[model samples]
Target: MGQSSSTMSSPVIIPAAARHTATLIFLHGLGDTGHGWASAMAAIRPPYVKVICPTAESMSVTLNAGFVMPSWFDLISLDPNGPEDRAGIEKATNFVHGLIEEELKNGIEASRIAVGGFSQGGGLAIHAALQYPKSLAGIIGLSCWLPLHKDFPKEAKGNLTTRLFQAHGSADPVVPFHWGAETSALLKQFMENSEFKTYPGLSHSSGEQEMEDVKKFLQEVLPDN
Candidate 1:
């Protein structure tokens, strides 16, 4: 599928109370804006970590029958193994990479940064972060699967020490648990540390237990001073 022009607004930012030493760029899923996840960021982020949530541009999604919504890329097909949207994925990756660069320019080292997302956003997180040029602190994927899986072996670079935390609901209908587990397995080949967790009767959304796991992952990877 063809991609649209690159456009972005000022991200919804939750700044740290003290001097910032780390950054987390979290992306929201399809049909959702950055604001939707702002409160979650506020709750889970560490005291010295600033969170950056960028709003995906509104676009017509093919799977949604051309309905306009905020999406990182066009969901061309619901089939997990169908041909992926390479163009749209590349565009979103560049956009997210820009955000990481901006943080780096502001003095946060790549080692102190993490990128994460949920559902569609989570797919992009694992896809892009593995291919990102610099090593990051962590990669968080919640209730989401990996996209462009085959391309990783050829295009993946950096972030060897970066830990990956992927959690999926075994009962999730949107992104199946098997897919998440498979992605986590593939990630283990590239990352030195990777963890995968499954919530027994949970659905496509996150809950307190998942958040607690995420909090622990963040603390272990990007601890506050």
Candidate 2:
């Protein structure tokens, strides 16, 4: 699928190589289209897992001097304590929920679907999975922090027990390494089934080891049925 004028760009769909027992809905980072992560995700996903990489709608990002780009929501600043775009985050999270609902309607159980992404998309994925009405199979976030972190554990209603694999580069400059650690700590306060992995010397991107860990996590959480 491709971009559209009235809606979000169509996702890059990688069909399951075997019987489709699970689905992974992955989102791309700011300024990036779904294609950015499609191939990598396709390569790492299990044979029974279908991967869907969705492109975010293009909009003017506040932090980029209002430059129009593909973003899940407007990033006001990198400051963890700074103001957040609550409305925009909620809207994007709702869109994620809609995607999950679509998968559910297509006969995939909520427990057979996972939501994941990188950077900004990963933050949105974390927020969306926590607030979803039904528990998901898993959650994966790489080099990302959680959006609206202050309201969590209380606002988090679903997927508390679902397995989560969060990886961060220790030297990440965009989404600081500290942010990922702090997010992990916050998640552990309420969710016991979460793992936070740190890649040494890495910066702002995924590594071979990290993807291997993610692949293992996916295989464990969405095993063949």
User: Which candidate wins on lDDT?
Assistant: 2
Which residue segments of model 2 deviate by more than 4 Å?
Answer: 1-5
- Superposed Cα deviation of residue 8, candidate 1 (Å): 2.5
lDDT score, residue 104, model 2? 90
TM-scores, one per candidate = 0.94, 0.96
Candidate 1, residues 79-125, lDDT tens digits: the string is 76798788889888888898999999999999999999999999898
Q: Which pairs of residues clash in candidate 2, taking residues 3 or more apart in a chain or in different chains? A: none
Q: Please give, for residues 1-225, the per-residue lDDT of candidate 2 as tens digits.
A: 333436787888999999888999998999999999999999999998989999898988999999989999889988999999998899899989998998898899999999999999999998999999799999999989999999988898789998889999999988899999999999988887999999999999888999899899989999888
Best-matching candidate per TM-score: 2
